[model samples]
Target: MAPSTTLYPRATLKKIVKAHSNRPLTKNVDILVFLNYTLFLQELMKEASIKSKQSGERGISARSVRRVREHCLRKFKG
Candidate 1:
């Protein structure tokens, strides 16, 4: 088990995994998947916010998110 930051509920995460997977996930795999998802979202949003600022936007917009999305994914792939 991970230290429970609990950004999202465990049951919700498990449901998502179940919906996609052919086999059941282990408890640790569930936590790891959820953690990675949250981290990716966090990084994506952070990059989008910065992109918005650079373009003189007041806040993150869909366009800003779209622009920075590939860059954020590349960071994760490394």
Candidate 2:
């Protein structure tokens, strides 16, 4: 299998977390940690759905994407 490429670099993620630190609420902090990943996945699903539509295939599901997003948020919550 090929190596996985990182969508967000460590420094970028650190910056996001740092920026959100100003708020310091539990919900905001949780969003700060998982925002990048959630956004990435959402974009990925959007693209995949578009491509699938072009190819006349079934597209990605919004419900499934939400479930995945919630799972990540829960996993990253401290």
Candidate 3:
């Protein structure tokens, strides 16, 4: 199997979670949260790109992202 590479800094994720949570987290928890966050961004970008294309835009815009944000959230809802 190939090695896994992180797109964002693990330290930054740790800091963000640390600030919000009162309890300490294990390293695996940090990795899981990082992975989920990355996946959320990927899904959001894909939806935004499709929205932009439908509107004849060359790139994803903030408006496109805003339009699809709720859809993405609903799809990812647990």
Candidate 4:
């Protein structure tokens, strides 16, 4: 029998589904979701599609990234 080859933790299971899709995501939401949920690229795509509008893309800075990362790590890092 072969051992499982998955590398990501179970907390990241949602991401595998996301990445399977070929559609790409905008960078703004990409950073936000990753900073907050460590979710897969596809989940970020779903989030952005629902939340974003015709505007080019949201501007996200390093400070905001750090803040979100901290919040996720503290709140959802379980």
Candidate 5:
């Protein structure tokens, strides 16, 4: 199973689901379309990584970028 879905509170999750109910992620659909294209996620993630690196942010790491990119790609392709 997936991690506990408590990432968001029950109410907030409900709102998010109900609000985008029409465009909800289908069982077989990749979640990239939850916004638009998967590449957008890749680019944004890269940009955030660059920003954190420049700012000397301590916690963020390059592995996060690769993980997010791969997750998005896999979700979209499969």
Candidate 6:
């Protein structure tokens, strides 16, 4: 039989739900899905940026990282 699938990986969805558990209820499932996608992209960008700095290659700008960080903080803050 095929393994069961979820909208997101179990751990990722748990982390997302746990992170937002104390926040206001303005966000719905659709918004949560978007947040998950954005957060994943942000993490990828951050890692790439870090690797680029280490390898002496230009990745995303520091300002862009800062903006994403702040946006995440705002979204997840209780």
- Top TM-score prediction, candidate number: 3
Candidate 3 Cα outliers beyond 4 Å, as residue runs: 1-27
Pick by lDDT: 3 or 5, better one: 3
TM-score of each: 0.65, 0.37, 0.66, 0.27, 0.32, 0.39
Better of 2 and 5 by TM-score: 2
Over the stretch 1-78, how does candidate 2's per-residue lDDT look in tens digits? 787685446566566766867754443444455676677666657665665566566756665455355555564455
* lDDT, residue 67, model 5: 46
- Indicate the worst ten consecutive residues by lDDT in candidate 6: 22-31
Give the alpha-carbon lDDT of every model: 0.86, 0.59, 0.87, 0.46, 0.57, 0.62
Candidate 4 colliding pairs: 15-40, 18-42
| Range of the 10 consecutive residues with the lowest summed lDDT in candidate 4 | 48-57
After superposition, candidate 4 runs with Cα above 4 Å error: 1-37, 40-58
Model 6 residue 75 lDDT?
A: 52
Candidate 1 per-residue lDDT over residues 1-78, each given as its tens digit: 678776667788788878888787787777788668789999999989999999999999999999999988887763
Q: Is candidate 3 or candidate 4 better by lDDT?
A: 3
Most accurate candidate by lDDT: 3
Which stretch of 10 consecutive residues in model 1 shows the poorest summed lDDT? 1-10
Number of backbone collisions per candidate: 0, 0, 0, 2, 0, 0
1-78: candidate 5 lDDT, tens digit per residue: 779954335455445665766675544233423434546666657665776677677656666565466555665563
The CA-based lDDT of model 3 is what? 0.87
The local lDDT score (0 to 100) that residue 10 gets in candidate 2 is 55
Worst 10 residues of 5 by lDDT: 26-35
Judged by whole-model lDDT over C-alpha atoms, candidate 4 comes out at 0.46
Residue 22 local lDDT, model 4: 57
